[model samples]
Target: MVISNKALRFIIATFVICLPFISMANPEKDTTIVQTVVAHEGAEASHEAHAEPTDVKSKVKAFIKHHVLDSHEFSFFQDDETGVHYGFSLPIIIYDNGFQIFSSSKFEHGEAVAESNGNFYKINHHDGKIYKTDAAGTITEDEKSGHPTNVRPLDLSITKSVLSILIAAVLMFFIFTGLAKSYAKNNGIASGAGRIFEPVVLFIRDEIAIPNIGEKHYKKYMSYLLTIFFFILFLNIFGLMPFGINVTGNLTITFSLAILTFLITNLTANKNYWGHIFWMPGVPKPMRIVLAPIELLGVVIKPFSLMIRLYANIFAGHIVLMSIIGLMFIFKSWIGSSLSFGLSFALSILEILVAFLQAYIFTLLSALYFGMAVEEHHHEEAHH
Candidate 1:
């Protein structure tokens, strides 16, 4: 039953090694939120912020003056003779009559259009006359463009986050199912795919579950731990790839994971765990009354912390990497560009390790909660 000093020390050392990586990842994400707020404030201070730019910002802009327009969308060669690449990075929805595009690149609203009866109509930005287009991309008479209809395109493309989660889920199903089959075929022992997974599963069973929850109750909690460990681990790794999707970077996904942990913790709690929470045996009656509220609050806060920790770390890392890349575009200088490339490269390597470490921490905490819930209390009198 005793945990050796050496074993305890190793646990401490492992945490020390991984803590900074997780912590750094969070601040980078938080800073972006702060900066966005500040930028919003700055924009509010200027009354003429809506005016068209009288000056060009970069060499590319100076070269392409003619092609660019005051509107967010354009379809011609620039003043500098740079031809428009309609095929590259085209917007999903374009308001051709209104002279605007719903492009992530252009971002700001340049013009507005109206629609009616499954057709789109817009007042031309130049002369303010209405034009119409049908569902099949055909221009129609102005009389037909008077009904309210959806002007958006039916692109139905999956966002990066959704696609990433789907890919991660499929990969986990394949790898773990293969491991399970490998173990089944090898006389209850593992081989092949199982060999890679067996050690980690055994560690969770032998070290985490049995020691914390006791031998009798450990098996009941094993499947949940294994599933969580692998799920988070898979998603984290996928978030680090080049075309990586930040599934855990999403607040909703992280919150759902935390909610599951919360449910399991409460549902699996033995009589003793609840008894201690509501009424401590040795504590004063007056203190127990006050402590009851604190204990109850702890239940909610624990899962909330789990949600924020995972979400913040993943979200922050991605934002930092993207912000550094954004800086390369903003600076337009070799020094800034080269530094951004180097820092992004180094941070990316660190993020890969972090993807594993955060998954382990989340799993470890969840297992600890499960252990607390199912742990059996020994009778002091029987021991004597």
Candidate 2:
């Protein structure tokens, strides 16, 4: 029977499954594994027909991990039964001992090892990393851990995640640039396309930037705040789609963004900022010395929290949402599947709110940090 379901079901399933395949090397032998779900009651199957998908348990875990991790290609969709992928292949570039560039299609959807420059390299399916091996393509296993033990190449391929980042960047460039030009044409007043973004830009300026940083210094830092706000918002919205673009969900991405905030905070800091950390003017010398270490440590802690907060929220949300949708396939029954799907639909809507919320939180906190950095201290008038 066809596995097709309702449009909502299809969307949830599609969202749950359209993960990228890094590439996996199977043995020369091909296994023909089939799963049959009998629809009607028969003489032989009079009691009940219970059919489970092939390797359900392991496949489920791999399915989730595949969606979460980065891959060398962009897989739009797939057919689980036939294992047919309907996505375009991306270019794969590796630097082992020398540079080797080839299309990921060379792997034939991980059915075969890719040969580049007379070098045989296979994909470690277990971890989604490429490994160098002999012509036989033997992947050694570590005794301590059942993981693959093979030398890896410097993989610098344009994967789905990387492509998504570029897409967001290009989109932002055209959008903001157009808005800026429209404002210029209208004699500093928002016009045409600028009307759409004008409210948000003003909100950030009036609500976020001005309130957080004083009016004098707010303009100087407006560019960074607006850029980050939209940059993260685009990524968070992109991730909600079935395309599997988890740019902000990655810790590396979040850490880099946090580092940017940290640098701007400390680098642009006025003397008052350092004075508070090193030696508070009003506080006694002994107390100032005692507080100095804690204040300095707080500087590091601020950015670290920023990194973990964005990463943890986005990453955890994806996992929870994916796991809920995955339960529908596992249930395979009308009632259970319906309940699982209902929950998924609710969470999906909530995720939309979260997408906007995360962007705001990041921007708000960043503006607050800017305020602290550029804040000026007042001293009492000289006493007689």
Candidate 3:
């Protein structure tokens, strides 16, 4: 049983050499370490996936589109941590079999279904339209059009645009009413806020209404001209505010304004105006018939142009301005971000001027149309 020192030393060396391999071969410990590493990496990836947008361009485009589109709620901003939106909800009024009225918050930012009078409704995120859906909030889409097949109720909701319009209207009423009272109080001299706005009012009456609509007839249309000018100006200014209200940029709103102009022009047209359009006094009999339809077509084209011009200009301005602002976040560098911020600020200032310019142009064109409709033609005097 006497062991040699050489054999004992050999055994010790062999054990020392194999210790690392034995540890490496242990499956349970290695598996636990591997699982821990994998779980850490997976969690980091998931956090990143949720925290940041994968495609910056797509995010920017979506933000711009959302800026220009009307929504049921006035969302100021969203919290990054909680993912909760900060804004008040407007009322949603829909007429199906009967009126179904509810607060827009019931939709939970288009993530939930709203029930009323035994009917269920859901908001289509794609178009922001409310559609009748089942309790599960299932939406059936048409295969060809890709639009929802669910029946849409008659929407009479006071959307963001509608709310902005109402605000502008109330603001305009108070402003002008105060101005009128000031004029009456101060012996026809406007005081206070009236003093500030009087010059603009006189400019509209003198430069726009009288020149285009004639001094004799301008008085009757001055009230409407002033109302529209300030109404549009206020809405455009509102759009540029941080509140994200794009009332004037809405097509339907512009269309409504154009319709008002159309009605006023044609309804107040003189007999001479209709005569010039249907049967030109100066043209040959055969040629007059040819020109008549074309002239009548011009009537419809005029208002259509007004609607398109206002809508396109305001809508495009908002998109461009917002896109520039979005570039600041994408750049992620001091110099590039500063440049983007500078450009955004300059564009915002220019947008303020555009807001006024658009209002002026709309008012000017509307007055010009009135001038054409009420213009007197002295054919007898011209013949003499």
Candidate number of the best TM-score: 3
> What's the count of clashing pairs in each model shown?
8, 0, 0
Candidate 1 on 193-282: residue-level lDDT in tens? 657877888887887777777778878888888888778888888766544356787787899999999999999798888877897657
In candidate 3, the residue pairs with backbone N, CA or C atoms under 3 Å apart (3 or more residues apart, or in different chains) clash, namely none
- Tens-digit lDDT track of model 3 for 1-384: 987999999998887555433432345865675586567766676454224444455578777877888999999998867989999999999999989999999999888999999899998876889999999989888878878999999999999999998999998888788989988888898877767788999999989999999988988899899999999999999999877888889999999999999999999999999998998887778999899999999999999999999999999999889998997766545555666788899999999999999999999999999999999986662463
Which of candidates 1 and 3 is the stronger one according to TM-score?
Answer: 3
Give per-model CA RMSD: 14.6, 10.8, 17.5
Candidate 2 lDDT over 1-384, as tens digits, reads 565569779888765554211112231211222122332325435232223224544456666777777777788778977979988888899997789999999877665789988998887665667888888778898768767778888998888888888899998888888888887887887666657878999999999999999988999899999999999999999999886678889998999999999999999999989988998777767988899999999999999999999999999988899888887765544555666789999999999999989999999999999999999878742321
Worst-scoring 10-residue span by lDDT in model 1? 63-72
Best-fitting candidate, scored by lDDT: 3
Candidate 3 local Cα displacement, residue 380, angstroms: 3.0
Model 1 misplaced stretches (Cα beyond 4 Å): 1-160, 331-335, 379-384
Better of 2 and 3 by lDDT: 3
Candidate 3, residue 164: Cα displacement in angstroms equals 0.6
Judged by lDDT against the true structure, how good is candidate 3?
A: 0.87
Reference-based lDDT, residue 209, model 3: 98
Error of 2 at 94 (Å): 2.4
